[model samples]
Target: MAKQSIAEIRKKEILSTFYEVAKVEGLENTSFAKIAQKLEIQPSLIVHYFKNRDELILALIQYNLDQYKQIFSIAHADDLSHQEHLNKVLDKLFSLDWNELYDDGVYYSCYTLIFRHPEIKGKFKDLHLELRSGLKTILEQCTKAGFLAIEDPATVAHQVYNLLDGTYYFVSMLDVKADQEKYLQQSKTLAKKLIGLH
Candidate 1:
């Protein structure tokens, strides 16, 4: 295989370093210098990869969303009925068995950053809309398969997507065991009812 390009290697190193720093020190406290220190590289190296902190954050947001698409795509892929597939997706999302080590923290961090930084907030919102669009397509297919109600798939998809986003927001904020399970189960019930699967 040909050697990886310098740009590819630097991008990979930067993202990996960013995640490590964000995971340890809350994302709110992460900085380019911290990531540079983590990688034992000069801060200028990080700056070279990302023009500024805002650009770095945008890259991180894309990375986070791509990860979600990867997981959700595989988890929900099957030739089952719409309701059956929806049920499986919900179970995969709301299961408490692995809540302690869930990957939702990265998203929470990204959202929190956007909430604080209004200038880049639009980009974050765009990414969210993109996610909702994907979900809408899947839900529309389910409706055609007689899995969901005969309503606007886009509208219904937004409802389901918002509920999930809100639920995970709360989940990432609380103590993993405190009321996470209770809230997630309640979310599952509500999502089922909203999607008319119950």
Candidate 2:
């Protein structure tokens, strides 16, 4: 692997701090000074990397997309069959594990910008496309392995992705754990039905 440049390292550091601060204070409330204070660096250093708050926000959304991709990763275990691997992916998709990946408040706050910011909207579209593509690839593999019978992996992938998107958004608002689990299981069942699974 090639070594990371200083600029690359500093940018990631700034984005990571911004994410944490945003998670607590919200995207609208988080400022460059807050991020710089968290990093114990001068505000000018942050300006050196990001031209403006909008630029930093865009970079943070990309950072979020990178974090969201972790859900698709499967642990390579010799004992796990293709179907088992796909099952694991679906489980992760519907589970609260995503809550650990990023804050719902920060993500939804950024999502609202799609209406006002075309660039943010495009970045979000890319995030969705990449996620669906990953799911489609896994579904196709399962079909070829005879573990699934999806006729159109792309459509099924899109449906499942939508299911997860709606499920997570709704579940994020519930104050009760049981309610969240109930909806999550229901969504998973719906996803399995969509893919022709029992």
Candidate 3:
């Protein structure tokens, strides 16, 4: 595999640090100096790459969205059966750690911040719908293969996405007994019931 250039590596490091910091300190408190401190470098290094916090965050959003696409592609580009495919999708949807397909902290933070930033909202909306459409495609394929019972893949796709989002955002905070496997099983059971799977 071709190695990433020095510039590319630095950019990744900076973005990772930004996510870690924002996830901990709230995106409101994330600053170039804080990122620099986290990386043990001068703030100028970050400023040299990004003129301001908005620039850095915009770049991070772009970087993260691309990573999201890669994850989605890998998960769907497999030969899993209908049951196995639903499991794979939900495992990713609910932030399961075994596969580690998505970064929940960064993903949630971007979603939370979008409320105040319309431009970011637009970008994230596109990414969100793209993933939902991917799920719709999976459901349609699974149904064609006689693995599912959903007649309205479009509505089911949105509903499943909402379930995943709500469970992660709210249930994760309110439910003390939560674990990845439990959520995985719950998701499986729910999908099965939704589509009348035996």
Candidate 4:
């Protein structure tokens, strides 16, 4: 693989630090100075990569989408059968592993941007569409492999994703582990039912 450019590496570093800082400080409260200080670099370095706070925020939203795509990555694992891969994808989708991938605070903060920023809203819509498309591809493969008999993989994919998304949002509000697990399992069950699985 070709080496990453210096600018690419620097921007990634800045975005990662910005995410961490935003998680702790809240996205509205985070600033370039805070991200730079966390990275132990000059604030101008961040500004050089991101022209303004809005630019940084937009980039961060994209970063959030990228992080979420990690959930479906197991679908490409070479060793697993299609059935096993789909199970793993479903399990990961409803589990707390997603919470570990990205901060809830930061995610919801960016989500709220859909109300005020058309660009952010468009990016978020793309993110959801891409996720649904990925899942649909996986379901289509399972159908072709005889592991599933989905007639409309695209519709099933959308339904499963909506189940996962809504479940996570509700689960985030509950403080008890047992309660969270109960809801997650319910969501997973519903998702399986949607996909014609038992």
Candidate 5:
């Protein structure tokens, strides 16, 4: 168990290094040697775990999706009010100083692979469905609590995801000062409108 734990830790560290390097250098330009150099480890170490570039990319995608799953844990499906419950969800979803969560470059680059690599499409499809269902569940709760009047939680969830994605893309590319706060506020306001809360 201890050996397995260490292997898992090393795998996570390697994947994280790859993610940073890929985002900075562009995924197409990234190589196992670059990730190894970034982590100051043997390139063979990465190859030992992941046979090649495509394998590593797939592993990183799974790792990122796993990290995203952690966000839902903050929701705490208990007796909390709809507003309170949704607040916890929204806070993680959109923060003024958020940089890490969106992972704009890395995420978008991986998304492009679904078209080129076809086999990877199911992974993304499942992830989006998971996110949509989770949001829809929370939205259903809000509707039951009488705080939100949304009739189609599924559609609203997709809209909210798109809003976040688009905002992340714009914020990452543009050099607008204080744009993060503006984007987050815009999302929050629009969410309220969509749910008919305000």
Candidate 6:
């Protein structure tokens, strides 16, 4: 059990190193040797946990999804209404200051790799679907409480997701010195309006 625990810890350490290096150097630049160097271990150490580069990439994808799941955990599922739950998710996504270690740019990078690279498409697809369903659940809850129109909550959730994705893309690329708080406020306003929250 001790050996297994150590292995698990090493795996997590390797993943962390991969995330930091990938964020700075991009996914294409992430190599086993680079991660090994960062962790001060043999490249084969990574191979021991991840069979290949593709496997490592898949693990990173899972890590990204886990981060979002954690965000949802803090969200108020029992808020006064479905709209309130939707509001909490949006606030967590845009307003809450996430750590630089796992900032919006990190998510953008992971998402970009998932879409642009076909090698790991199959692995990422299920995770993406799960994320969509999670978002839709929040919307459905809002509709149940009359906070949103009784139209298709899943479709509306997808639209809200697109808005969040677009904002993250803009934040990742643009060098504008505008306040994130203000931008987040505008995002909430638009989200409410789109959901017909009034």
Please list all clashing residue pairs in model 5, or write none if there are none: none
Q: Report the C-alpha displacement of residue 135, candidate 1, in angstroms.
A: 2.0
What does the lDDT come to for candidate 3? 0.73
Q: Which stretches of candidate 1 lie over 4 Å from their true place?
A: 1-4, 75-78, 96-109, 112-119, 176-178
What's model 1's TM-score?
0.81
RMSD score of candidate 6 (Å): 3.3
lDDT of 2 by residue, 1-198 (tens): 999999999999999999999988989999999999999999999999999998998998898889989987777834688788888988888888866698888999999999999999999999999999999998998899898888899999999999899898899889898999889999999999998877
Per-residue accuracy of model 3 over 84-164 as CA lDDT, tens digit each:
876566656655442344456666777786888887888788877887888888889888988887889988888877776
Per-residue accuracy of model 1 over 1-198 as CA lDDT, tens digit each: 999998988898898788778878877788988998888989998888889988887888777666555435544367676666666666766655434332565657677776678756877787778877876776788889876764887887788878887887777677757588889889889877777776
Q: What's the TM for model 2? A: 0.96
> Please, what are the lDDT tens digits per residue for candidate 4 over residues 29-112?
999889989999999998899999888888888898899889888845899998888889888888988767889999899989
Candidate 1 vs 6: which has more lDDT: 1
The order by descending TM-score is 2, 4, 5, 1, 6, 3
**Candidate 4 — what's its lDDT?**
0.90
Q: List the pairs of residues colliding in candidate 2.
A: none
Number of the candidate with higher lDDT, 3 or 4: 4
In terms of lDDT, the poorest run of 10 residues in model 3 is 94-103
Tell me the whole-model lDDT of each prediction, alpha carbons only: 0.74, 0.91, 0.73, 0.90, 0.78, 0.72
**lDDT measured at residue 11 in model 1 versus the true structure, 0 to 100:** 96
Which regions of candidate 6 fall more than 4 Å away from where they truly are? 1-4, 75-83, 96-119, 177-180
Candidate 6 lDDT over residue span 83-170, tens digit each: 5666666777665353232656555555666576786676567766777788788777767766666588778777776877666555
As for lDDT, the candidate ahead, 4 or 6, is 4
Worst 10 residues of 4 by lDDT: 68-77
Off by over 4 Å in 3: 1-3, 63-79, 91-109, 178-184
